[model samples]
Target chain A: MNPPLLDVRGLTLRYETDAGLVTATSRVSFQVNRSDRYVLLGPSGCGKSTLLKAVGGYLAPAEGQILLKGAPIRKPGPDRMMVFQEFDQLLPWCTVTQNVTFALTASGRLKAAEAEERARHYIAKVGLARFADRFPHTLSGGMKQRVAIARGMAMEPDILLMDEPYAALDALTRRSMQDELLQLWEEIRFTVLFVTHSIPEAIKLGTRILLLTPHPGRVKAEHRSDGTDPAGPDGELLSERIHRELFSDAREEEAGHV
Target chain B: MSDSGTVRLPLPAARTGAAPAQRRRVWRNSPLLRKACILLVLACVWQIYAVQLDKPLLFPTLTDTLQALWSSLASGALFTRIGFTLRTLLMGYAAGILLAGVVTALAVGSRLGNDLLETFTAMFNPLPAIALLPLSLLWFGLGNGSLIFVLVHSVLWPTALSTHAGFRAVSPTLRMVGRNYGLTGLRLVLRILVPAAFPSILTGLKNGWAFAWRTLIAAELVFGVSSGAGGLGWFIYENKNQLEIPSVFAGLLTVILIGLFVENLIFRTIERRTVRRWGMQA
Candidate 1:
């Protein structure tokens, strides 16, 4: 097998506050192979989002390093695009096509016409072809999130970092989004480092789940659900088992931490 | 989870219902009728009071005022005065808006710029632009330069304050999204920051326009010019001195008319096209 696409080691982060230094993450380590849907799961304030940010080069880890494709990660670039939790992630001023074109042009990967064509293609892929000329403000919450996803995917990043991209969506919409995401994953097969607190979401979406303990987060367990096809018949049983195991581990860890 | 334990769902509607024409008519008519009634009541009260006083110097009746207005329009003097005032106002408004943009950019871009803008706005925002007219006259002489100076003073602070507030109100998520698209510098400002802060900027523009209008008229009245190229304010002042009460009332009415045209036609149209359409403001 080929070596992992992303490798992180001994990662630690501390934020400076008026009160004092607050530790957010400690000695977190992980590796994500190409085409791996790696979900980081933990309760709120567990530094899962921080870890994703660090990996995406939005934040610097106080200790250790992250290597992407044998190169050390430094600052944020088009190679790692992020989809934030808020539906407002798509800039309200931009039409759907412009939002995607913005990413393509800014990356300097294509000329204006070519970038527009690619933007149209991705906007279509995300089922937003009709909304290409519409501003984000006019879109429903689910549609806005899809636009954000299209914008991220339009960059064709080495790793897509999602910080609870569907946590804000209503349950029905969230489920539809998950199915769409899985369909997109099947087509594109890009490495993804997704952060979410939901057990079912992790089992349904992630090929590998990295469970972290809350408050100064550290990896508690890693579960591989590679064979579980969430949309298949037997997938429900496997998802339930994964959910049970993850929640139990989370509970035990929380009890131990307290 | 099986369909066997569940009740069958109802069929979806085949067609969506359209809004009733009467409902649309009512929605359109109520606001217009209400405003017209209010204006009629105010005019009746004013006409009654003017007749009771029976002093043309003190107050002119609405019909007399309307007659004066008609005469001014027929002679083209009112149009010329309005054109002059509007020209000065547009120039000052444009300059003030440009300055506010620069100041806001500096404030958002650097610490020192932020401090400078904050201090400058705090110092000047509360000072009336009319009060600055004496100093402006001394510095620039009693010409259009002085009037423009006072107008700029009137417009700049409120525009800057609102713009800065808008910039500060932009959410972190939106900023992150812009960055994710590799947007920075001028592109970032134009695409993300400007639109996100637009509602506030629109408010600032409206306030600044009102201030500049009021300041221009007051300043022009205080320093009435002898040249034929004087504004509505000068027209009002000259008519008042000559005891032409009806013309003075006409000049005042012209000012109100211009203000109404700008507010309802220009600014309202822009608000509807942008912020209201975007649902950022009503």
Candidate 2:
């Protein structure tokens, strides 16, 4: 059998603060196959985003290793493009087209003219072809996120690591953005390792969801959902089951505290 | 509970989402017109005060100063002075900027460079450039060299300080995004740090320009006596010795006009094109 596209073996992550070393995650392990809509779902402070960042090579692993196609992941590279949560992710100086083109050209993956052409293609895919020449500041929060998504897509990286990319949007915009992401996934079949705290979001987006416990996140469980259906063949809600699984840890911790 | 009858009325027809008629912008609201009016009032006050004082030696009337300015322009002496002063100022300013660039690059490159920048700026930034004139003259020997030295001194510290601060203030998210694209070292600095820090850098450049201009004028006032040929400062100084008070006022007016032109026209245009365009500045 072919090795998983991404392998996390006994991964541990920590960062320094004013106080001291803070462990974000410990002994977490997961594998993402090609085209897997892998979602890391957990409560806040669970280090889900940190896990995604570690995969992106922004955060160093304190133990074990992260391997991409059997090769160790090191510093950030063009191979794993990241879509961040903040709207400021897009360079304020560049227009939508230029922002996307910059990702391609700056990575040296494509020349200027070719990058521009591919940039426009992805911009069109994101329904931002009309605003291709407009700057990021002029676009709404949703539109700016769209430009960021286009920039990541334009790179055509080995995998796209997204860290709560739609969490900052309003309810309506968030729903629409989720739909748009699924649509994009349909058209391109791109591999995405998505991080979110919302249970429904996890069920809605991920083909396989990796549940993590709160604080110093550790793998709780991994569940496979029938790709676009939130309902199982047995007529149970996936969100309810996942919610129980996540909160069971919280209840046990509360009992211990009491 | 009893049922109550309610009346419904049709709303009156009104203009709904129609475009407003296009009209010319009001002259009363024009910034240029407002500023010009303020200047005119100030000029009138100066004219009235000078005429009442009737002491041309101390304070020349507005009309007399204008006459001196006109005569100087006609003889081309004033033009020569202005040209000499600008040439010297440009030389010093360019050298200052070059040195500031090097210092800033060094500061951004490493921790030691940052410490050096901080320590050097703290030592020099507060020292008035005019205070360095005597030492500059002794070193460079009574020429444009001395004037240029003081001007560079005035420009360098402020430019380097602001630029270093700007680079330090670039958002970490932006830095990460740049690095994520495989941009490293010089490429990362150019693509991310420089542009992101531009608003601060521009502020630095403006501060440096003002400092250099002030230092050049003050330096020339003293250095002009030692050097045979000099610029507007010399013109003003020579007139003061000969009791040409009106000519001295004319030289002063030329200085103000040049300052205004650079601030309003040159710097404003650069600000509009870059920082304002990028929405980094209001």
Instruction: Report the number of the highest-TM-score candidate.
Output: 2
The segments of candidate 2 whose C-alpha lies over 4 angstroms from its true place after superposition are A227-236, B1-28, B225-227
Estimate, for each residue in A1-258, the C-alpha lDDT of model 2 and write its tens digit: 779999999998999999999899999999999999999999998899988888988888999899999999999998999999998888888888989988899889999999999999999999998999998888999999999889998899889999999999999999999999999999999999999998888888899999998778889999996555466678867787788789976898899999
Error of 1 at A213 (Å): 2.0
Give the TM-score of candidate 2 (chain A): 0.96
How many backbone clashes does every candidate have? 0, 0
- The two-chain DockQ for each candidate, comma-separated, is 0.42, 0.59
**Candidate 2 deviates by what RMSD?**
6.5
Highest DockQ against the true fold, candidate: 2
Over the stretch B1-282, how does candidate 1's per-residue lDDT look in tens digits? 568434333222212223456666776879978788799999999899998889978899988999999999999988988888888889998998998888888898899999999999999998999999889889998788888888888999999999999999999887776666667778878878888999999999999999999999998899857355888999999899999999999999889988999999999999988887777882
Model 1 misplaced stretches (Cα beyond 4 Å): A227-258, B1-30, B37-57, B226-228
Q: What's the distance in Å from true for residue A91, model 2?
A: 1.1
Model 1 - which docking category? acceptable
Per-residue lDDT over B1-282 for candidate 2, one digit per residue giving the tens place of the 0 to 100 score: 333322222122123312221112444457777788799999999999999999999999999999999999999999989998999999999999999999999988888998998999999988998899899878988788888888888889999999989998888878989989989998999998898899999999999999988888887788674445688888898999999999999999999999989988999999998888777872
